[model samples]
Target: MHDFPDIDYTQRFIFDESDVRGELVALERSYAEVLAKHPYPEPVAQLLGEMLAAAALLVGTLKFDGLLVLQARSLGPVSLLMVECSSEREIRGIARYDESLITPDATLQELMPDGDLTMTIDPRQGKRYQGIVGLDGVDLSACLSSYFVMSEQLPTRFWIKADGKRARGLLLQQLPAARLTDPEEREASWQHVNTLVDTLTAEELLSLNNETVLHRLFHEDAVRMFDIQPLVFRCSCSRERSANALVSLGLEDAQQLVIEHNGTVEIDCQFCNQRYLFDATDVAQLFAGGGVDTPSDTRH
Candidate 1:
């Protein structure tokens, strides 16, 4: 990084006179906190950082009160990489990889040369929407940008970078126009802003502050900057939520699982590695009372 202090935050900005809006996210504490839960290899860790950054950037663009999940699965060395960002700005992520297949310096395409990039937006008040795209790009940023271009038909670009220490990204999109809008002028603005942001280097993206990066790229324009939003590494899983999930498995199925497991049902969160356990009493109360009435938490 640079000589500046480390930061874990996301900032949104838009050109005051144009239809181009963008967001910049720099994650240090949150990224390292998630990695602290698991000892992922270098390549895997970097990929997870990218996903976490992507999740943070995407979460702010929607108007939902739920969760956004970014999952990449492949038959290659790295089988899974997942990140969850709640509408509240809490983030968590993890990766599953084969140590033998991963090199000390492996690129994303090498580790996950072929996979599906899955983006899920679940609203608390409406039906969940999921979009899937083939991982045809050489990097994670390119793949996500491709997803929006084909799936959402939005002119978008992503500049994501991560070392072992930090994860950061910048996103730019052409906003939807209103009636009587000029298509040619809108397209010109998109191209102009993208061309300028394309000049950002990874060092500047990850090291400098959000304002500095913005001014460096868009100093000539009247860019309106919004208040910075803080992002923390938080896990939203709880015994009650897990129990509700078990209840969905049905009374008979849940009890059967408890019996096979020798007396209690256990659900482990892969993101935080915390285990939420429920005993016979808990299970009975969960079904009989319609919830996880037993609040016993065996965090592992």
Candidate 2:
């Protein structure tokens, strides 16, 4: 029987002796929240959900206090797909796919034919960094693991699963600093744990609770599980920030932008599909140096 829970869960676990750690994230409502915003194709929605789950899992393991983004940029029908997750587990995501007809069994290659997977880490008080990698793998999880191996110089493995209900993933990393003298033990332990994780199926990942998943993967080993962190869907878009951006553009550029956009420069928040419209007067006020005016909230 599958041990399922009513709430989504993201938890960190560590081995007692090995320099290895793992993260398990099971998401349902949060994944649904992201998919509700746009009418994405089936493959695109699945890809975004998988990426979101992977981002949450990465956030659980990383030590940075900033936002981490997973982006897939392509020249195919699907131009771009991204998921941004903060260290605090707040996530927002969206995907752009050009195709109108997407079948249920569509693969990542079908959605993003020619694309590159990039990971960006933006700290609150440091220089932002980005790493680019080719999208040779078939799924988002594979691409993410590739990024970790290339960027962090760590041997990492990822197991990701997603469907209409929710998306989930498990991550394992063998620390780079521990490979000096006694590499055999750590590598053996990592292989032992990963071998068990390989038996996990998409249904088990999406349906099982965090503790259950951990137990299934490492029941015989000594696994120290951390407290579960709550994950939520949040879009950090506001009229004030939008207005500030307009002001930063200065007067001349703002005027040209308004004219180019037919006197109304509308910026839509991709995650939430919230549109922020700035008309000529709005642009003028922004450039006139007045405090940003509150936009009348309009909901579709």
Candidate 3:
């Protein structure tokens, strides 16, 4: 396959000696594509980036053929931040915030006062699962760490960073030990790995590639990493889906909208800024289970 520079890939690693695992995710194109759809402020953009990166990392550890959604909502200026990553690594995200109240330097708690972070896994065949935690920590990393510790009782640490252009994240978790026995041994191993990870700087993470970053941090250990998994920006919204949404509004409303808009009903995809157009006839065919198309779907 093609090799992309400093963007759209995840690397998972495990130390041979310790019962610990780690993941590194760098999102460049996907993050930029999401931002291109909406002009989010610096602070809101950062929050969205963190959620995007975190969603990718969380998906790495699970085995499900569905979508994983990470959402944060509160009664503050930044009301909602949501990111969705599918099993195929197709990702999309959006944020709703009061841009007028955003300051130059806004913290997560400030942006989402009384907020709750919710992670939902919607499987293709099985039942969906959701876990939620309050926004008690100072930042996204801390809050997520707390969630894992309290909810799953796993020792997990995260270091995430984002600017206007890139979002990068590192995750280290203590797994069930195979070699190390006793609580003290496991604790020591966790500390050893964490100490190495602690030295990583935000600049290096956002700039360097996966191999360089892993080596720079864990060169002394017996760390083994699998091949890179690529990520891309993709929206699940479609004309059929939009048509069904319109159909949900009942046949009368759908026809009314078409009449009000000059015999056309237009819907926009928030993730990708794609528009789907449906006229009166298309709506009739749509409810009849016939196929539909968007402006972009047609051949030039």
Q: What's the lDDT for all of these models?
A: 0.86, 0.81, 0.87
The residue-by-residue lDDT of candidate 2 on 1-300, one tens digit each, is 556566667888887767788888888888888888987767777788888888898887778999999898987767888889998888999888776646678787776776898889999989998889887787877887787778766788899988866888899987654532466776677788888988998887877787877888788878898888888888888877778888888889988998999978888876797888887877776676665554434521
Q: After superposition, how far is residue 210 of candidate 3 from its true place, in Å?
A: 2.7
Q: Could you say which candidate leads in TM-score? A: 3
Alpha-carbon runs more than 4 Å astray in model 2: 1-7, 176-181, 256-265, 294-300
Best by lDDT: 3
Worst 10 residues of 2 by lDDT: 291-300
Q: State the lDDT of candidate 3 residue by residue for 97-150, as single tens digits.
A: 888889989999889999999999999999999999998898998999899988
Q: Which of the predicted structures, 1 or 2, would earn the higher lDDT when compared with the native?
A: 1
- Candidate 3: misplaced stretches above 4 Å? 1-7, 293-300
Model 2 CA lDDT for position 131: 86
Q: List the pairs of residues colliding in candidate 1.
A: none
Instruction: Note the clash tally of each candidate.
Output: 0, 0, 0
Candidate 1 per-residue C-alpha lDDT over 188-294 given as tens digits, one digit per residue, 9 for 90 to 100: 77889989988888888878887788888988998998888888999988777788898899888888898999987779888887888887777888889856554
> What does candidate 3 score in Cα RMSD to the true structure?
2.9
